[model samples]
Target: MFDFIKTQVIGVTTPTVDFIPTAEDLPAFCARVSNPDNQKNFDTAAGLLKYCMRVGHWSVFDMSNIVIEIEAPRDIARQVLRHSSIKFQEFSQRYAVAQNFVIREARLQDTKNRQNSIDTENNYLQEAWKLKQEQVLNLVRENYQWALDSGIAKECARVILPEGNTMSYMYANGTVRQWITYLKVRDDLGVTQKEHVDLARKIKPAIIAHFPFLEELMEK
Candidate 1:
């Protein structure tokens, strides 16, 4: 039963975001910005919010609150931890056993630049690389499970898992200002891990939905 529970929780690819506002919910936030003090000091005219965001009056943008969670590979999660703005809660292998690993078709190593990669469109190479990863992952999982069954501590047993393991990452209560900072860096084309870039793109819509002004920032 515990194995089933663990498998069901960890073995999924679809990223889940909770409580992001729908189209109907956006007007309330607009209204809040239009009349922050109930005195209607500002005319609440068209393009007001965009102008504020452009000129760096981020206080109004700070009022927008959105919470999202991401399930990402451990390699990508490490890069994400560099963003100090967003609060995070992540799955701890020290406390719990890992149930899944992230395995992807290996990219061709870029010969021109040691830090870069090229697309591996060759089917034969892709298949061989994937098979190799799966075989290694199976061995790792088998050994990890044996350690657990033999009464080894989870904290110590987890050392056997590789950096590409899957983890549930929860990012809580990010404001518009912080979201802009996060997306700007992580969404860059030069980011080391493809997983980080992909996850950032996936989460972009939720931020744009609530804070359309951020769309301009994204374009930059």
Candidate 2:
């Protein structure tokens, strides 16, 4: 039901079992771990990886790397930006076009659960809300364009745009260890914002692809 949140993981490069090894360095490292003398019995890289996670050593996870690009409403963008550990380069309204993409549906506030939403019972009313949001956003866009044409600075003109209606995108760059911390909190069901949880779920599989034992690590 939530199609508004768009994201992608690009330029992914993950580490092998070694903490500081190059791409060509993993097989030999795994072999050392699997050496008969050591009796570690790690038959494969994946096995050694499992051991690393099982031991609760997160530093090894720092070897895995990725950059995630996300296109979302400003509200969601604000939530994502709260993750101070990860580096982010966001689309700036001061420099670029401010695409005011409105979120049309109005979610019903749950009285018992503050900061949570429930489905509105009336589908017809929801449609009306969509139309009204579109009308307001169209006016906003027109005024924004007019200000730009009238020689107003983009930085100044952007003040007219509503934070909830604007679209902001960003690239999040970090290691798997950083992301593990992010996912643990943002992916939790207790999180009031469903969009953040949706994004975490979507990117988890990509993380698992590089670190096969990560799902088990997260469990621990």
Residue 74 displacement in candidate 2 (angstroms): 1.2
Clash count per candidate: 0, 0
The 10-residue segment with the lowest total lDDT in model 1: 1-10
| Candidate 2, 1-93: lDDT as tens digits | 347777777756634345534431243253354464643333455666666656666666666567888888888789888988888999998
Name the regions of candidate 2 deviating beyond 4 angstroms. 14-43, 215-220
TM-scores vs. true structure, each candidate: 0.76, 0.80
Q: Write the per-residue lDDT of candidate 1 for residues 1-220, one digit (tens) a residue.
A: 0111111111111113333233222332454555566423233422566666677776655555567777676776787777868766778888888897766756777787776677766989878977888898899989999999999999999888887755555554566567677777777655455567777777787666655555765777
Q: Give lDDT for model 2.
A: 0.71
Instruction: Report the error of model 2 at residue 98, Å.
Output: 1.9
